[model samples]
Target: MNRNRAKWLTLMTLVLLTLTMSAQNKQKFKVVLDPGHGGKDTGTNHLKNVEKDIVLAVALEVGKILNKESDIEVFYTRSKDVFVPVKERSVMANEAKGNVFVSIHCNGVASSSPSGTETYVMGLSKNKSNLEVAKQENSVILMEDDYKTQYAGFNPSAPESIIGLMLIQEDYVQQSIDLASRVQDGFTYDLKRKNRGVKQGPFWVLHGAFMPSILIELGFVSNKEEGAYLSSSKGQKELAKSIAQGIISYKNAYYNNGIAHTETNVNEPQANTKSAVKGVTFKIQIAASSRVLALKPQNFKGLSNVTMEKGKKINKYFYSETSDYTEAKQRLAEAKAKGHSSSFIVAYKNGKQIPLEEALK
Candidate 1:
């Protein structure tokens, strides 16, 4: 009887341990890191500096830093110097159910004068420089087989062609912008790199990922000084560390705001009354466009209380604002019912953008 009793207790302990392990796994934050350009693509090249080699090295280093955290899981689109289609990169991130997708690359142009790091979230922009960058990156699709059919006949040279794909990522635009801003802040303050500031552009990879996504232009490789620095191990390590820290900071801030590290928490309403704090204002972001539209009911599905904020590159239209978190959610639902399917709640305080999670607190 004593031996049988001992065996029963051991069995129960083992079962409990298994359950605990499963729960911890579910809490892990999944990140999909994509190193831009590889194999035959080679990306942009200047003298001895190759875009593929530099981005791959930095991406791997960033992955190493994130892997040390027990609660963070990193997935790589490609660890080796192999070509990967831009479309396939996002498909991989979606399949892994990543919480965020970050694609790393280097910028280049005929003139070597431009040098700075810029991060992009998917959106339309009329700025000539922004459109040029988008054109250069989107041109990669032309290399793929039957690109026309795959991309619905998207003309990479024509930045306007990407408008059709805009709605797919509209729901997560604010989150993408939030993550991009953190990355830009890290590059600017920590490394003291040229602060290109966060901007919007239509990139195919950013559009395909279901979660928040950003494409990073590490720096202009065409510039001789920046090119050599990007090629150095020290520069790569520093940049990687900065990128890793930004991701960590974003994860902690959102996680504390009731946004879990798990993939299941995405695409759902972020506002909750339980976490709402005083002085927080919530607004429904209905649409963002390059065209300036009058705040007329006719232009917005006949919805009233419409307002607009013009940014550096785009104009954002909002439905209404309120201090009550629950009421803000009701407005979000109303906007969606009015054909603004991608509308989401954005929070603000003192005219500055704060995380929906932060505002909720």
Candidate 2:
């Protein structure tokens, strides 16, 4: 090769290698640390004081540690004692391109006996207490009229509470769950606190976040002992360290596995709301020895409007009313898609099961 061509080739190769290394070294973890209820809005207060101060102290310490210890860039919603509305915090974090958001708060209940660390992610709640807690936490939105717009139009009622969660529609759901689990474990093992498993519910602060977000209630302020621990400097350091480590460990798993793609989120509910079609009457089974003629009127007189279809090696039954022609066709389509052609209904009339004829009228 000519000297000029050889020199150009060497330069091009060096340029390509540099770009590749830069892409590989790009930051994999970007976190937003939110200390719940600041300034005038002192969330839930104990005899010692409000939860706002406790969470801020912990969040500040956590952010400092994350910045000093790891390559992760931690964004804070508030750095000092100031009121940051729910809408503003979410907007600021998203603007900063945060990948994950962690909201820190202290749990509270009327009874001084209740104590534990509960972590919440956006979703529907099933329990009454959980629903109440959701409402209490979510009320922070009242401070902002545009909170609805801030969270990408998340509806507190019906489906809106669940649908807006689609933005994170990637593998982050499981990753968020894993991080929450680790934090709970850390609280139990390292901090000697009660562990509440990762829970799903609607939180105003989390509803609009485009990335994986979690709200952590680190022990009940209602309980005297727990409140005291949360107020102390040593307890603050311990709590912050445990939470930061959980995030580090979780992010390490993804980076270690070389997972560059985001996870898909299944936010929408399925159209088929589970029906309450009860009773053994709903189930129709056939006998192993039953023949196609078993579907005949005289053979199965008591059975009403039974439909049957000839199977490759067996017969199938269907209920003329509930499992009508249209439903049968849809199920057949689903079965065919799954490579299963033996998709048919079997009816149980009396004690015998009719096969081919039993599945059809």
Candidate 3:
């Protein structure tokens, strides 16, 4: 009887300690690194340099740096020269409950004049250049068996096919944009590379990822000088270090219980004449651009109540405001009718933008 009681007490004590430890420890941030293209699918073959080999080397180097950080847990879709389906890559990230998914690739073009890095988040883009990039990347889906069945109605060559298929990632759009902006800053400022800026495009690899995801086009492999640098050991090391720094910065800002930092406009006046309102507000986001425009109705297609919010790298213009959700939807239609075709309704709690669904709830 004494022996049995002692055994039961020991088991209960271990269980209590496990529960306490689990409660005290926070979950580690998991990042999924995917190196694009491999095996028979040599991404872009420029003379002796191959895109697959370059990206793989960079991705491994990034993993090496991130692995030393105690707060982050890193996973690779493919650490070797093997091909993994795009859908499978996202699935692996999802299965791991990753916080972010980063797909790395090298850009190629017929002309070697364009030499810059661009990071992409999943969304339908109207820009012809953005569509072309999406098309080039989406064509990889064709290499998979039963891709037509797998992707359903998605046509790699048709930009219209991706219009209504981005609902799954809408909730994560802001988060993905935040990370992309950081990565672009690292490329431009830290590595002294030309920044092509963050863009939105229909990347199939990013669509299925449940968390914040981005596809990075490192640089143009067709440009001879850039290609030589990209294929070299020193360049790869620098690129990897820059990328790792960006990821670390983002993690510190987002997952360390810190507030998202915004840049302050130095020239703007700090005087507040109006009293702060205390309810949820909705606005129609008409445009987001790197350039700041004059805040006049004539500048934004006769939209009278145009307001601009400056972010770290871009300025967003919101047209009209309403406290009602239905009225906000109507305002979105109005903005779209006035040539702001990409306009959407955004919700704000107090002053900060909150998720539309959460605000509605």
Worst 10 residues of 3 by lDDT: 260-269
Model 2 scores what on Cα lDDT? 0.64
Model 3 clashes, total count: 0
Model 3 residue runs over 4 Å out of place are: 1-19, 22-26, 257-306, 310-361
| Steric overlap count per candidate | 0, 23, 0
Give the Cα error of residue 51 in candidate 2, in Å: 1.0
lDDT comparison, 1 vs 3, better candidate: 1
**Most TM-score-accurate candidate:** 1
lDDT of 2 by residue, 1-361 (tens): 6999999999999999999887767654677999998877888887875789999999999888888754588889998788898867778878978767899998887889988888876655455556667767766665665766765665554344543344332224434554676677788888788876677665767756766678899888889988888888988899999999888765654342223332111111134522222221222222111136656534433444556645322234443433333343444344334433222332334433322222332
Worst 10 residues of 2 by lDDT: 261-270
TM-score computed on alpha carbons, candidate 1:
0.78
lDDT of 1 by residue, 28-115 (tens): 7888999998888888888779999999999999999999997888999999999899899999999998989999999999998999
lDDT, candidate 3, equals 0.80
**Candidate 3 clashing pairs, residues 3+ apart or interchain:** none
lDDT at 203, model 2: 70
Better of 1 and 2 by TM-score: 1
Top candidate on lDDT is 1
